[model samples]
Target: MKKLLIVSLGIIGVILVLSPWILILFGRNQLHDHDIPQQEQLVDDREKHLILAIFPHPDDEVTVSGTLMKLKEEGHEIQMVCLTRGEKGKSSGIEDEVELAKLRTVEMKNAAELIGADHLHLLDYPDSGLEKVGLDSLKKIVGELIAEVDPDVLISYDSKVGLYGHPDHRLTGRAVEEVFLEKRGMDGFTPQEMFQVTLCKKQIKIALKLSSSFQKNYPEDPKQGLPRPDFSINTRKFFPRTLQVMQAHQTQQEVLKDLMPFHDKVPTWIYSRIFDREYFREVK
Candidate 1:
């Protein structure tokens, strides 16, 4: 009886250690079984096209890095405007806000370079506090960027969905939308396409189930509508570059530490299951 008890405890320990690996293998196999088709239609008239992506924080850009890489490869000039330097973001070690902001700025620049972005506009809004910014102020800043870049394509968060319901994200989305709407009919200000960075409801549900970190950060709220993706880019080909872009944000390592085990050990197939596609909603 004593030996049996010892064996049971040993088995539990082994299972605890191996469970994450098991889940990753299972996920990879499932992805292999259910293959999704890649989008092959290229952009029309690609000569000297410009794209601008606006997001609330430095790391927020990772969500769309795959799509950005694809656009870059297709020869469209890309730029990113990060509203804040992420001064209020969590740091791996103890650091003051000013120091953290400078670190995140460098990290964001490295990430933008990896994605082949032509320019990175870093705004001075307070991190995690964008909601406090007045609407006029928000509009003025984004409007100036739009005028300067005159982007052919614009990408931003969805105000309605507000990925993870972050206040900064919501505010950024609203501001972008307001500016885009206000400038749509003006000469040389209208973008050919406007896309909201988003995940499919199905993917979001799966992520919520699989990632405890995601759950902690974004508590499920039925009040918020789940965005239905009107467009999707199969990012399987750009997944490695996306991972590299993410890795460039070294200061935010703790933010992704939970997934590193799978990221480091699992086959790229795991990423195919997790981040194979970048989804968006077209804002007409």
Candidate 2:
């Protein structure tokens, strides 16, 4: 009994000594901007502009929903486009693709309504088969959409890595970025800036633990963590709206809960501490 007690005490002492070192080494968040008060100077409160986001799936816009709400409150128009209704994805063991497609479209619309998106465009594109649609064709369609919207700001995922290396997401982001490049300096019009959604190294590490989708899709390169965000949007002021947006996509509850297991079960403030910051890399 005494030997066991000594061993336990020694283990506790080692943990206590290594606690700060462990946190310092492993718990360091890879965000480029630390504790930005509310928002970046990129957005001016006085000027009204249109913000547009294009994603492959219904729930993808949740990434920037808080920023959308903030922009809306400041009198900016928000428009979200989903290239696919996420029919190819599984949710809650639902296997009927056609049924899930319709259901997801409805959920997307509901979330768009809650986001106060002035326009919610749901396009029917093959979900997981975006690559099959081919890049040039996708670019033509995306370019036209951008031309029509004529947004001041554009949003999409990281083209190279697509956050966690989702193939559809990569295609969507590549299409958006390529279109933006083509339209830039055109005679017509183009967005002043484009921002790509990204998760930091630490965030992806946490996500791998929670979501099997991420674990499977994430690159096997041990060194290839998600890019460090160029800046962080402090969305703490509008976390309530963010939570509502998260809840709007009931079909994606598993994905949301993976990030925060007790998200809605606990007080909103508790989760806001981790989620209040939205990360992005500005597209040049």
Model 1 alpha-carbon drift over 4 Å, by segment: 1-38, 45-48, 210-223, 257-261
Instruction: Give the whole-model CA lDDT for all candidates, comma-separated.
Output: 0.76, 0.79
Write the residue-wise lDDT of candidate 2 on 177-247 in tens digits: 98887678877766888889887666776778877778888888856646667777877777887777778
Model 1 agreement with the true structure over 95-133: per-residue lDDT tens digits: 688988999999999999999999999988898877778
Best by lDDT: 2
* TM-score (C-alpha, index-matched) for candidate 2: 0.84
Score every model by TM-score: 0.81, 0.84
| Candidate 1 least-lDDT 10 residues | 29-38
